[model samples]
Target: MHSLRPLIALLSATAVAAPLRADAQTFEPLSTCVSSLRQELPAKVKPETFETFTRDAQDLRPVVDTATKTQPEFQLPIWDYIARRTDEQRVAQGRDIVKNEQAALASIQQRHGVDGATTVAVFGVETDYGRVRGAYPVIDATLSRACLNLQSAERKDHFFTALWLVQEGVVRVDEFKGSWAGAFGMTQFMPGTFAKYMSAADDKGRVDIIHSVPDALATTARYLRGLGWIEGVPWAVEVRVPPSVAQRWNATESEHGCLTQQSPVGKCRRVAEFAVDGVTRVDGQPLVRPNSLLGQQLEPSLNAALLMPAGAQGPAWLVTPNYQAIWRYNRADAYALAIGLLSDALRGSAPQRTPWPTDDAGLSRAEFRDLQAMLLRLGHCDVVVDGASGPKTSAAIRDEERKLGWVETGRGGQKVFIALKKSSAPEVACAAAVPASAPELAASAAASAASR
Candidate 1:
């Protein structure tokens, strides 16, 4: 649901455009699927509803399969991920939305016990202030995923529930369109979440997140509250970690501390504990201050996890449980960080003081595709070159790193690209020089000439 494009051009290219419906087909796979749904859903959903909806269902395997393979979370670097979501232009636009919708946001916050800025941040990031609610039909997407077994059991259940919602007339089938993942409306609520937490902001009793700003914000606020969002706590605070303190806290030495295997963002420690370790707010001020949100509302005893997105040399943050609430909206760490940073910017906070510690900075989609191609040629990976650095791609990178005697971080960067280019150049040259029919002979002749 949280799609971040690198620039405006990319955003326009990928932005939700006109709906592309699948051509009608027999959809043979869904026959048993509908029968299973009829048996499984009747207790909660009426049997009549299930029977009626299945009559018109069509296959959408192509669209659903393509989306499943290309999610940005596993591909984009942390910096690129955050930058695209929390761009300066987006922040400025969000601030304007906060100002224009002040009364509605304030009321939603008061009722739901969630902050206005955070709600706006969700809106801004999820759909770019509702400018790009996805163009895929909800029924087509959900039913396709359910019938084709595109996701896990629990996720398929959600898709089935969405179909049930359509059948029951809770959301009209024709009007209900959203992302390929089946999350709908302005804030992108999955059917299960919508069924549980949908709320109307006006007296009409119509909760339309797709069309109404107030309703969407209110629904988002209510959803966050259900996720344990504390009323006034800051999601995260940028921090400065002393060199000596960082040296003492080795990320790989223990499985329990910050940035460990078990807790990649570190375990939560009390603010006092961080103070003793010489960690301070990034602004060179005390962790608690009169004007700060923590000083105004949160207790000193609150625990926060230390997060370093780009290893120890990069910017650091003390992320609170409120951060977890944001993460619940989307499970990716980069997504959560983008929301937090965007929310901070809306409140007039400055950008990160410390830059990410990498010479190459970030990978473009083209660069990522090139990396995948090189890995494939080297016999390290077998995935399609779609620019997404998924599990197979990461494993391949680690394998290549090991071959080069480099540390196996499984990260894609300029160094890896350069090394791969150098390693592959001779092979490329040799293949280009020899005729395809007599490659072995050409190689043998070259070897003989070298020996002579």
Candidate 2:
């Protein structure tokens, strides 16, 4: 029983914490530590290909115990996990893959200044526009925790990132595979970030990201110009402020004496003393501003970080240093605000006409699976419907929106489909109440005790 499912599937990251430095001489114990570190790896990889890749990395440790028991046993309902990533059929197939890849996304934004709407919002938030690049087995999810030695230097840093994608032939050992955290193409990346920022020569000399749309939009603008991406700045925006401003904005920059209205003293008064086209003095009086848009007017000295990750009630932006270089591809804040709101909705920018605390009747996916089948007929939650509202269906829709007095709203909206359509009717209307019975043997014994 000591297997807390390999420490909750290696600390299921939601906010970049996967760093885990590990040492005590790379500790041992997971049964003679994966056969003494498979004798320090690399022998041009084969011994019946390391025993059929350790029997397919011991069959994906039961999909991290079936995505943590399918999220809570058929009681799932944050409007079925945000209606599977804001679906309107995945935003009308991400507006036809941004209009049939506009000349391969404007020659990958003129050779990697990185913007084609944040590379089609990182191809519409990692594999939706391409549609789910994850079934698993990128060398069985990087040798199943680098052979279950767990965080041993971040699973030998994703096991030498699947042996540097098979020594740069960019994946082929049964055509590799992806996600259960190995991440793959069409924006999921992660072969040590596609070998530190992949790019293919766009103005036309070829560079493909598994089948060129000008090499996956210039290998995601040469992996956000090797993670310092700043071309025209703004990978964060949605500002509208004015409730007399000061909404804390993640405090500590010496608690606001850095004049924090989220650093708007025209960007911390030329943050670190002047030069974007240099000239400062608003209340003091002088102006010039035009630093660099990167195209015909480029100028970067690099220094930015203002991230507003959906707090203080949602949109607000400033983040730069090419927005933490798109958090090295996929370290979420809703995966970098869905690739900075699909690069401002592929330059057209809608869906956020500032109405994300919904209720003017916006709750579909069959009303979020009829409010997760009325939160599994009312005993609260059971998990799967996959419309997605996550964090245990916003803690069972904020515990049934605090027992109906409502206000808890971690948002599934339409008041969680009118409180699960008033818990699927029959409360008094001249009938014997009924409706309950859908437990399916405690959701089939919690999905068969999570595939054990």
Candidate 3:
């Protein structure tokens, strides 16, 4: 992830939700930004190009500012984030994509030494295989971020790059839309990143990442390859750590330490070193090269760092330099783990072996939707069943949590899901703010169905 953008994942239950209005108020005006940029725009972006493109730029500071703070990585619990991102529906869709786009994926692997699953996993995570390329115009989004952070050279460069892309007809002006932080395309590349790596995979013409799947995947593969993604090598492998070593190395306070400063196991070591230190493969395979890694001509001396995303007692992965490459892509352990797990799932690997240390486990996207629907039946709150946890959904879940006498986390965890699932009908005023009759009628209609 960009230093400007921050981390990825489901926002933690403890994260303080920022109201949109409060966040939006912090920004330089559009007129002020345009004036400053006219003089300070990078030399690579011609002054006239900046003037022509940003003339109609919208002040998106309010929305962008809120979005920057609400990134899931910094908010959601690790388990919830992983469950939502690597759920069954996403896995099935990834498999279908792997089948349909096999040729392009194969070509990418051949050309770049990047695996198809990893490439497609990035596709799934970035823009949901091009389904959810953001709504903000790249010009507006970039300009908004630039105005928000005047000292950030990356944000300013991205804005000008967006302008240059539009002016060159490489990206149509109408199609220049992306995230609040200004990343766009099927694989959500920042404008500057796209300019550097967005070449056609087939070498036929200019890469059209917005319109071409192969080109988007190609750009992603190229980036990963540039980041040193090793072919046929896993990013990491789930491992079992002996209790003796686990006690000494476990640092729940620094859960993402392996990716942040250095490995928590102190330093990167050869596979033999890990085996010697009592780290064993989870699947009863050799520590040096597990069965999943066999036939790849892998050596025992391949470097790996111990990654305990939860704690030493919880799931730990012996992450290789391949994991380092993926971490370099986003610099978040959860995001890299998502990519690793999703890619493995696409390749017919079973789900995660070791569970997180929490009893109130996370729900999948579909299960989350079901929870929302069940909440509606139990008169918890009337909200969309889209599975995205918004203010209304969180508040509703908190109400249910309060009813159960648990601490109010407001997260749609399995505890709330199971409780709501078993509740037959509306027993209380769902939303005291809303009319009591509304929830009663809806719950009455769905009562018989909810009982089952």
Candidate 4:
């Protein structure tokens, strides 16, 4: 089964995008899922809800399956991912949301200790501030995801819980619509998260994250707090890694003990630890100071993970625990960074200072699909032609690199595509089989033979 983190990211990106239409062969009935739910969730869900849910549930199995295979995190370059999510238009819209929703956002900040800008940023990224909430019926999407063999047991549990919410009258099945992966509401909460952290801002005895902006923002703030967002700490700060510093902490290393073992976002150490090793801010200033958020500064002892999204030569970041909280919302570094950067933009901070290292940028979705097709033709990969770069595609890239005696970074880029094309060129193949000097040598051999 694919990882749930990428699945969540995929769902978030495609929630507003059109869903794939499935033919009869691709579609599967929800009878198995209904049976399993009855067996597993009898105590938590009532029988009538199960009957109603099954009656209403449409098989979106094909859509969920395709979506899981083509997640944007695995397909897009980090720079592209961040750029699309935190574009100038998104930043402008986010600022407007911050202005218009000030009172409601301030109330959430006071109650949950999560900043309003950050909450608004989450709202913008999750569903474009409720403008592009998903179109799929949540009951069908959840049931579809729950029944799939590729889905994890934990995911199945969560889908069942969503049905239970419908059964218990927490949310109506008719009104429940969301992404193909079952995340709903303005801020895109999974059913399990909604069950735990759904909140109501006003005295009305309801917590509706689906339609109410204030309720959604408050719920989002509550969710972030539950994920361990510190009140006044910034999620991440731009930093500079000195050229003189040793290369042991480079992200490419497979063995770094605790640094490699962290979950979701992965890797963390105290800022002082990197300071001891010569890392500093872009202005060459020491990073021993406290983390600042809005106007408040946090103590310097907080642990932060160093990230180089584009490798050693590119931009660097010191991501705090609050960054991890953002990551918990969608477990991609690119997604978290987009949220942080967008929030900063909404608050009038400058854009990214450093550029990505490579001149070849990266492949687009179409380019990646072409790369996958080329890999398939070369017999290096055997996966579906989805744009996502899964383990099989990465290994295939490494295999091709090995054949060309190039460095085995396993990253798909324009260079890789060019190399594949050049290697497959007829002229290049002919030259490889017959050296450039072969014609001259043939003439010389003929002259020698005639003389003899």
Give me the candidate number with maximum TM-score: 3
By TM-score: ranked, best first:
3, 4, 1, 2
Residues 225-288 of candidate 1: C-alpha lDDT, one tens digit per residue: 8766788787877889887766554222122233212223455566667777888888787676
Better of 1 and 3 by lDDT: 3
Task: Give candidate 2's error at residue 197 in angstroms.
Answer: 16
Clashes of each: 2, 19, 10, 0
**Candidate 1, residue 234: how far the Cα is off, in Å:** 0.5
Clashes of 3: 10
Off by over 4 Å in 2: 1-33, 36-42, 45-82, 86-93, 105-122, 125-143, 146-161, 165-180, 184-186, 189-214, 217-388, 396-398, 405-452
On lDDT, the leading prediction is: 3
Model 1 worst lDDT window (10 residues):
443-452
RMSD of 3: 7.4
Candidate with more favorable, higher lDDT: 2 or 3: 3
Q: Write the per-residue lDDT of candidate 3 for residues 1-452, one digit (tens) a residue.
A: 34332344345654423333335255546888788878886667777788777787778788665655565655778888788879889889999999999988888889888888888997886656776666667888788778877897877877888888887788998887666667777777778778887767787888899998889889888887766677777777788988776666532213423433333345556668768888877876667655565432334667667777676646888777677776666656666788889988988876779999888888998998898777776665555576665666677778778888888888888887888778765555455433223212121111111000
lDDT of 2 at 220: 68
| lDDT for residue 83 in candidate 4, whole number 0-100 | 54
Model 3 local distance difference test score = 0.70
Task: Write down the TM-score of every candidate.
Answer: 0.69, 0.31, 0.86, 0.71
All candidates' lDDT scores? Answer: 0.64, 0.47, 0.70, 0.65
| C-alpha RMSD by candidate, in order | 13.3, 20.3, 7.4, 15.4
Clashing pairs in 1: 258-266, 259-266
**Model 3 Cα displacement at 48 (Å)?**
2.9
